[model samples]
Target: MNIHSVAPKRPDLDRLLIDSALALFAERTYEGTQMPAVAQHAGVGVGSIYRYFPSKEALGNAAFRYAKRTLLDTLAEALADGGPAGTAREEFARFWRGFTRYASAHPDAFVFLEHQQHDTFLDPESRALADELHRVAADFIERGQHAGAIRDGDAEQLVGLALGAFTGLVKLARPAGGLDALPAEDLDRAEAAVWDLLHRKADR
Candidate 1:
């Protein structure tokens, strides 16, 4: 039998590699991380990494895309629950809580994504996904504006402001230890601040 033909695809191994890569990348950064380190972290041979990903760059992009998709999927689910129709503040609050929960629970994935946002290793597909995420966020902001709950302004600009605030809060909440170590009250304050920034003056 041809060895190549008989080689089994190990999705478990692939997941392990990606998870390990995310943790290492978050701790050491993309350029500072190596395939050997990832393999060692995953308790696999260095050559095994190439079976799932051709190169370090490929692994980085794959990890980023995976994390981004996971985050987006979580947000989608948070928005899917039947809530008060057209109640933008309630919907936004639910989504924000879900986002922070995910970010805190999966700090490695969140950190990896945050650090790789501008990485050149990201392929066209990854770049497109990033754009899609932004579009989704802008749409959410536009919905609030349409409902007269958000301040009147450019949707994208509003998104940028909200995103900046959330990102800063995430960073501040994240101590040298991790996001899970952040105080619950501090996280609550961060969410309130973001909500206040997005709320219309008339609604306040």
Candidate 2:
């Protein structure tokens, strides 16, 4: 009996493969990574990978979706309350903190997500999930704009700017050993700077 030909019977094994793939993808990027490397990293045979994912593209898409879903799930609780009356600023601040914390705690996932741009292998579900996340962010920006809190502009563009800024901050902080490496006061200052960029002049 060839064990390599058999699919992993345990869900945890699937998670292990996904997690291993995420780390490799984060370090080497999608194009640079290979299934054999991922299998080796996961301590599984190459055939085991194919048993779970038909091809390298499929595995990449699966890993991307896993990381994305994990991130969204992490934020769900923090964002559950939604924006209450007269609390747009507070809500945004809470969301920003939650996002930064998650990224810091899960650098591999964050890096993998940040690296996904113009990847043709991403499956339909992955693309849809990405679109949904963007829509959520754009909606938040639109709400802030209407409430006279955020700067007036195209909501999508504003979201891009905000996300770009956050991404850049994470990249810079990576050298310093993640967001948590920064002092609490420093994190606060960074968040304040981000808020200032988003805040309308009238609100400021």
Backbone clashes under 3 angstroms, per model: 0, 0
lDDT of 2 by residue, 93-175 (tens): 76786688679778998998985663679878999988888887788888888888888888888877777888888898898
148-200 per-residue lDDT for model 1 (tens digits): 89989999898888877877767776775555677778777777889898989
C-alpha RMSD values across all candidates: 3.6, 4.5
The 10-residue segment with the lowest total lDDT in model 2: 77-86
lDDT of 1: 0.82
**Please, what is the whole-model Cα lDDT of each candidate in the order they appear?**
0.82, 0.82
- Candidate No. with top TM-score: 2
| Model 1 per-residue lDDT at 143 | 88
Model 2 CA deviation exceeding 4 Å by range = 1-11, 81-85
* Weakest lDDT window of 10 consecutive positions for candidate 1: 111-120
Query: In model 2, how large is the Cα lDDT of residue 163?
Result: 78
